[model samples]
Target: MAEDGAAGGRPCPICEEPLYKRHCKYVCPQHGVIMDCADTFWN
Candidate 1:
């Protein structure tokens, strides 16, 4: 089964680990927040 908030199985550019969706952004556990969403600008 897939993880909740997982970013469509996309790998992190820094560590090659799976990215997770959190706070409207993609995060890498090892690297912290990796990418942010456009909606984040309003939050």
Candidate 2:
């Protein structure tokens, strides 16, 4: 899996909060938020 760089200003697709690099995925701490990176990046 290609690693996404540090998501400094990248907002969470769900909570709208800032995103952070977590392993191979961008994770959100605001549980229950459906954050699809692919969909978010395209839109």
Candidate 3:
């Protein structure tokens, strides 16, 4: 699995918070699961 800020180290699309890798998804502290493995990149 990739690190917290791996390939697409982008911010949350909704709130602009730092996104962290959780399992196969990217999560924002303010928002929840933002992106998953099925998706190409973190928006």
- Give per-residue CA lDDT, model 2, range 1-43, as digits (tens): 3245455655676778767656435665674333455655534
Q: Which sections of candidate 1 miss by over 4 Å?
A: 1-4, 39-43
Q: What is candidate 2's local distance difference test score?
A: 0.55
TM-scores of the models, in the order given: 0.62, 0.45, 0.67
Superposed by TM-score, candidate 2 places the C-alpha of residue 15 at a distance from the truth, in angstroms, of 1.3
- The models' CA-based lDDT, in order, is 0.72, 0.55, 0.73
Off by over 4 Å in 2: 1-7, 32-43
Worst 10 residues of 1 by lDDT: 1-10
Q: Between candidates 2 and 3, name the one with more favorable TM-score.
A: 3
lDDT tens readout by residue for model 1, 1-43? 3455756555788889988877657788899888776755423
lDDT of 2 at 15: 73
Please estimate how well model 3 matches the true structure, expressed as its whole-model Cα lDDT.
0.73
Per-residue lDDT of model 3, residues 1-43, tens digit only? 4695554456788988877887778887888888896786533
Q: Which of the numbered candidates is closest to the native, going by highest TM-score?
A: 3
What C-alpha lDDT, on a 0 to 100 scale, does residue 6 get in candidate 3?
Answer: 59
Ranking by TM-score: 3, 1, 2
